[model samples]
Target: MGNQRTTTLEARVSLAQDPATTPATLYELCSDPSPEVRAAVAARPEAPAEALRPLTRDRDRTVREAVARNPSSSQANLLRLVGDADRWVRWAVAANPAVDTRIRQQMVKAQDKELRGLLAEMPDLEPDLAAVLIRDVSPEVRERLAAHTEDLDVITALLADRTVRVRKGLAINQRTTAEHRHALAGDSSPDVRAALVRALELDEADLQALVHDRSVEVRRSLATSAVTPQHIRRALESDPDETVAEDARGYQAAGEPRTAHRRPIGKRFPGRRGR
Candidate 1:
């Protein structure tokens, strides 16, 4: 009896995994006694919608999650899976590259903050979706959008966000424009300015503002950042804040290679030292 069941499982598993397995065969496996066979069929990108749709409600979470993760799963099925009781199933829906825009709009209002945050990081998130996340109640979700979205308008809007954490995410985001960096340089929060110093490059005007910033933390970050233009680090050597000056001296003592002294040259010819 054991051997008979094992043989059936092997044959079904093989049938489920076969690239040439017909849709009719895959559909038949959905009702197979083994959950593994159902899950394998669910995960196949070419699995027909009819075969995957029923698996979305499979008693086994793995089978349902495989359907959620399958790009070939239809929007209607994905939308249903997005609300699955299992956290992994919902997350899989958010991470699916083929997730439809309408589904993302629903995700924006999901009670789960992590699920909403995952949607914020989608590479192709439309501006309308980005706008909703910008207004998300959770700072973490907004912060993730601020850090990753390439939408300039979204970045611009987030610059005015009341939450310092959201602005800090914008500070470090490479996609932020020169104007955005310059605007952040004058931010009221010392932490925001400090985060700005960690950017890949800063406008000369922004760098000058940071050089004289009242916050020791901002100046200190500027001093230690390997990308700080050589001349800017020299200016910090005489900073009124002793800690800032000390960090500048320490950066020099480390023999960090020479970097361009101004944005025009630094922007064109970046320093060799890996930051």
Candidate 2:
């Protein structure tokens, strides 16, 4: 093992850049003074459990996070990471599939909403626990769970959630019912309503309602969406907002039929390439 605590930048770069590194070399690099090297080591799927353990308490946040995400990290190392000061590290631990069942149970009731959201993504959470997460205090967790789970009952509740962000997540989910999509059309947030405009299940009536939205941005989304009804797109060609009117004209010029799953257009014009 290299007794040197620190390496030059070149050496550290080699640790990450070199793909052919041996497991023995990776184990030794686990203790490298450069946190990035340690992070790179933790990033390896073949990282040994013994080497991964000590880095769990590494002073650098990235190093700890890397360990939490490493597939080879042992349950004990992951458990320690579960309590890491950084929320993202704990999030990584919760996201790790190999985390112990006991630790997952503890995470189920954790106060941190991000931790709960990541936990909700795991496939094997208890039904009762899943329910608790659906009704979680944090809208982010609610949204995360709605995005991950196929539970219809949960979808129903999430569509009615007080937070627009949560409801928007439900609206964008293809599985959200048409009834739910229509109900969400009345959401106060234009962002939420605009999200509905882009949903695969959006009702024709809902699509029309958005075309007449007070916000030019909302109307722009309609013209931008590949699925905007021909009538609606025609109406937008005469919109007061020049930008929106131009988008309607562009959509018309392209002459593409409204598709149920059209290329998603945002605030920009349909042909306006790049983000």
Candidate 3:
């Protein structure tokens, strides 16, 4: 019996590597006694959903993890795997886009810190689930929600969070509002201030303020913003950091003259540079 199982496992492994192997053959291998056979079948892109589902309960956690990673795994299977005993298995389920909002919400509510952490890191989490995760007990979960959710209210709320990492995530979120941007401008943490500067879609006046921020990192990010005004550029021209100042100078130079003598460099520069 041992020799027969070994031979069966080896045959399945060989079939798993062959491009011409049929899905049916791969599915059969998914139930083989050897975990190695199950893992090999799970790794095949052509492996069917039936094959993946059974492996979710495989005695070997490694084989179960392979099933969790399979792109072909059904949403039902993924939902079940989200509560798997193994941390890595739950993490893999969270990473799967097919897992539904209900499962994500359940994972967010889990008592297991590691499971909650994995759910928080999932970028495709529903907007509502993300909002809830932003208030999770785990700071790591809140930070992940802050980093990925594009919803304005959720991000705004995160901006006021005591956790520096959560605030930093909001400061860099693209959907961040001008109100949030203004708030972050005064943040005590330099990292949050710098990320805020990068995230802010500011007008001329706000850009000017950022360029003059006490934090050199904030000023450096402002100089690199594509929407930075020419007046802001000129203001940063003498900035202490030559690299940042040079970027501002480049913006200024690009705007300088398609038609220079039309107006002085000073007057025309600001209006033209933003375009």
Candidate 4:
């Protein structure tokens, strides 16, 4: 199902474009006659800016896109890219963290949903703009907000959003309050309840609510997770479904040291962060 050799210019371009590519190889690749090869170099953030300088004026949109996405690209390069004929190039420039703050402020208001989606993940995103995106008509945008924004009130409101996607984002977000997790425990979608139980560091109190969820899948998720409290696991050891009960026994044995139910040491297994 995959090519094994790096013999072609196309194959060479793929290798040179990787972030881990050596600088000397990147320099050689930058001078390749193929714009595709050069585009690959432009995408490497670790590539020298001098190599990237020539690509800013490249005729190919793909090359320009790579330069626009490179975090190490200078403000001048980004400002230059912002005026490119392609909208996605400009979108890429707007999403660049190293770009000027003034430019980024304007980008936050871009009408394009996908562009807005990229802006949603920017670490320096304006607080007011963050609020605006949460209410945006795009559930995808709201989902990103749920994944990124640390604001408690925003996460709380998203829990009750009309769309399941937005609700899912909040359902797994660690910032979700115990109160919110309690409310979400009764969500109509088994997916939502199942997601909450799989979180490695959830409030121990959640087990009480989720153990009685309508979906066997939801109950099985709680039953099988080593993070489930021992008392809850003990109850699940006799679940009506034989497979779920078996899984509970397997989990219960692994859960002996998890008495406190605080996050497991050095483990960061979050609930579903994607659809």
Candidate 5:
């Protein structure tokens, strides 16, 4: 029996290497006692769904994982592996492009927060489903959603989320819109406020308002905001915080030098003129 299994494994490997090997040849090898032969059959592009289906139930997790990774496996086969005992097998299902939106939605709603978070980061994840993840009970899941989805409304909603960490994600999202920016600008947390100030592209009026914010850090940020207008400079000049005022003065001074009238050389030399 040992020699027969070894011979079968070697024959499967040889058949797998031949592009012209028939599906029947590969299918027979898939049932070989050796997991290595089964893995080889699982990887064959021409291996039929029927042949691959049995491997989904293979006793060896490694062989099952290889079956899950195979593009040749039917969607049904992949879905069956979605709840495999091994997390890596489920991860392979999540990573499969052929996994349909319905399956993805189910996975996104999984009881496992880790799986939900992983689904949130998939590039082709449906936007509406991603939006749902924005409200997931787990902060880590919501954080992943905020980091991945580009939907303006979704991000806008996340910006107002009670969780400061979620709001922080919104503040940093590049797709954040003007409305989102305005909302984050009013966030109570200074860290969230600072993140908004750094990431948002506020207009002059908005920038000027932030410059006068009660928080010294917010005011300090506006003093250096590239969008800070000439009028903002005047506003900061009168700011109560001396640091803010100094920054404003430096900004103004860099753009417009202080003029000092020098005594004209000709005026000083008038007595020597036209000798």
Candidate 6:
């Protein structure tokens, strides 16, 4: 009896893998007794919608995940799997690169915060969604958006965000205008201003003002940052705070030339730049 089961499994595997297997045959195998056979069909990018659609609701979780990950899966079926009871299945749908804006909009309403966060990280995120996610309860999502989004409205809104992390992210964003830098230069949090100092150039007026900033941390940040302009570093050498002055002198002595223009490092979301 065991030998018969093994022989049947081998035949199912062979049928599933055969290059000439017809869609009709794969569709027939979709309901095969072996979960492995069904999963194999589900993973095939060429599998017909008819075959992949039913696998989206397969009893086996792995089969459902396979369908969710298949780029060729119908949008309708992918949307159905987005709401799958299992979080892993939902994650597969979220991570599929072929997911459309409509799916992303739907994901914004999902109960899972991580799904919402993944949507927030999309470089091509629609402006309407940016307006909504700006108010997301998760600060991390807001922080990620602040660092990468180029939407003017969203950037303006984040300037008022009470979270220090969000403000800090805005401070370093390449999209921040000179006016934005002026506003951040006077930010209440020393850390926020410190992050701003990492930008290659600051409005001359803002740079002069930051030279005398009350917080030593902000001055020290400007003093030690590789991107700080030469003039700013020179002024810091005379800072009232001796430690700030020492840091400025030490950094200058190292002889690393500052960039002539702004070169924002890590300013854009990964894999989304130049889009």
Number of the top TM-score candidate:
1
- Separately for all candidates shown, the number of backbone clashes (residues 3 or more apart, or on different chains) is 0, 0, 0, 0, 0, 0
lDDT by residue (tens digit), candidate 6, 97-185: 88998798888888888777778777878998998889999898888889888887788999999999999989988888888888999
Off by over 4 Å in 3: 1-10, 16-28, 31-33, 44-50, 112-114, 121-124, 220-233, 239-275
Once fitted onto the true fold, the runs of candidate 6 whose alpha carbons sit more than 4 angstroms away are 1-20, 28-40, 199-201, 252-275
Candidate-wise lDDT, in order = 0.87, 0.77, 0.73, 0.75, 0.75, 0.84
| Model 5: lowest-lDDT 10 consecutive positions | 1-10
What residue pairs clash in candidate 6, if any at all? none
Candidate 5 lDDT over 110-208, as tens digits, reads: 787787888877776687787788778899888877867777767767776788788877767777767667777878887777666666677555675
lDDT of 2 by residue, 31-108 (tens): 777787888878778777876887898899999999898878888888788888899899888777688777787787
Off-target runs (Cα >4 Å) in candidate 2 are 1-40, 94-104, 120-126, 186-191, 208-220, 235-247, 250-275
Candidate 1's residue-wise lDDT over 64-128, tens digit each?
99999998999999999988999999999987878888798889889999999998888878888
> Could you give candidate 4's per-residue lDDT for residues 29-122 as a string of tens digits?
7667778788878988788887888888888888999899899998778877776778878887866768766666555666767767776766
Best-first order by TM-score: 1, 6, 3, 5, 2, 4
Q: Model 3: which ten-residue window has the lowest total lDDT?
A: 258-267
* RMSD from true fold, candidate 5: 9.0
User: For model 1, what is the alpha-carbon lDDT of residue 233?
Assistant: 95
User: For model 2, what is the error of residue 35's alpha carbon versus the real structure, in angstroms, after optimal superposition?
Assistant: 4.0
TM-score-wise, the better of 2 and 6 is 6
RMSD per candidate (Å) reads: 8.3, 8.9, 7.7, 12.2, 9.0, 11.2
Clashing pairs in 5: none
Candidate with better TM-score, 2 vs 5: 5
Comparing 4 with 6 on lDDT, the higher-scoring candidate is: 6
TM-score of each: 0.84, 0.67, 0.72, 0.65, 0.68, 0.76
